[model samples]
Target: MTLTKLQKKFAEGIALGMKQGQAARYAGYSEKSADTQAYNNMKNVEILAFADELIEAQKSMLKRRFSGLASIAVDKTIDILQDVDASPQARLNAAKMILDYAGMEEPKQLNVTADVNQSNPFEGLTTDELRKLIDDG
Candidate 1:
């Protein structure tokens, strides 16, 4: 459901952390009715949904901004790693940061399972037999 301009303003104010009465006032509600309007608006499903949407949009924007900053930090670390005049310890730290950020600091472990009942096609073949089989194939 589309919200009216006042309802949208109330939702935005709430999303900005204003109290309901304050949000109602911000939405242009009269001073005498601000509290009553706020109480009523709180029960409005459309306003609540719009407030939630605003919060999610804010979260998404922050994530994108933080990611951009992280990329710049990684790039500066790369520069430190390549600087000839950087101290050995500093360069080592930078290299370690790059590796950690790239998720290469710890080696990944994998598990392999086999079915005991499965037959091995070449299990009984001798080396010369394997060679002939390969040649024929």
Candidate 2:
């Protein structure tokens, strides 16, 4: 769609992260009425469609800029996983990296209870009990 000068500038400003009212004012819209103008402009179907295109274009640019980091991380983790000399903790971390790459974040259903009225657990223990606990640990 062919946009007027202000519409073009407004779209560009929005693409560059400006809020609607800010973009409208930057595009030479009246300062006092810019908020209303920005709201109305955002309601226009052509402007909405153009904004979608702008967002998708920016996504492509961003992906290109950061594309190599994921592969490098995966490769290093894989190497760690296959190395027999790696510490057990290190190998576990590498496995976690693979899970993270697959988008499997930690399991979320752990049930924990906190008793607000409960005093410190160790406060009731005698000195001998504390010494035994510390020695066991």
Candidate 3:
């Protein structure tokens, strides 16, 4: 999945923390609907895969940069959890810290469904009344 030059630039800009619209523009995508265009590009599977590779590389670099800190933090968190006198909130925080460090934390997806505007606006209307309403519309 090779990206064109513009696509490469767009992905790079995204990795560099630029907004999609700004990244698209930086990649020479000049359009009146730049935001929409950028959104479409970002949703492309190949582009997303490329971007993920770049992000994973950056994450690896950061992990190596903080190599020693991770183990120390995890050990301290385990100690906190095993302490009986720790506050409930403190224990919870320690749990979360370990989960986050282990990369087990993820945003939960919620599904919300609602029914609105269901009543017939022309309920109980006579034929003449309904015709009038349709004509008005």
Reference-based lDDT, each prediction: 0.93, 0.87, 0.85
Q: Which of the two, 1 or 3, has more lDDT?
A: 1
lDDT of 1 by residue, 8-84 (tens): 99999999999999999999999999999899999999899999999999999999879879878998999999999
Which sections of candidate 3 miss by over 4 Å?
31-33, 71-137
Please, what are the lDDT tens digits per residue for candidate 3 over residues 4-109? Answer: 9888788877887899999888888877866876899888988878777888889999999999997887899999987889998899899888888788966899
lDDT of 2 by residue, 1-137 (tens): 68788887787778879999999998899989899989988987887677778888999999998898878878989999999999999999999989987889888898998868867989989999999999999
Q: Please list all clashing residue pairs in model 1, or write none if there are none.
A: none
Off by over 4 Å in 2: 76-97, 108-137
Quote each prediction's TM-score.
0.52, 0.58, 0.48
Instruction: Report each candidate's C-alpha RMSD, comma-separated, in the order given.
Output: 9.4, 9.7, 18.2
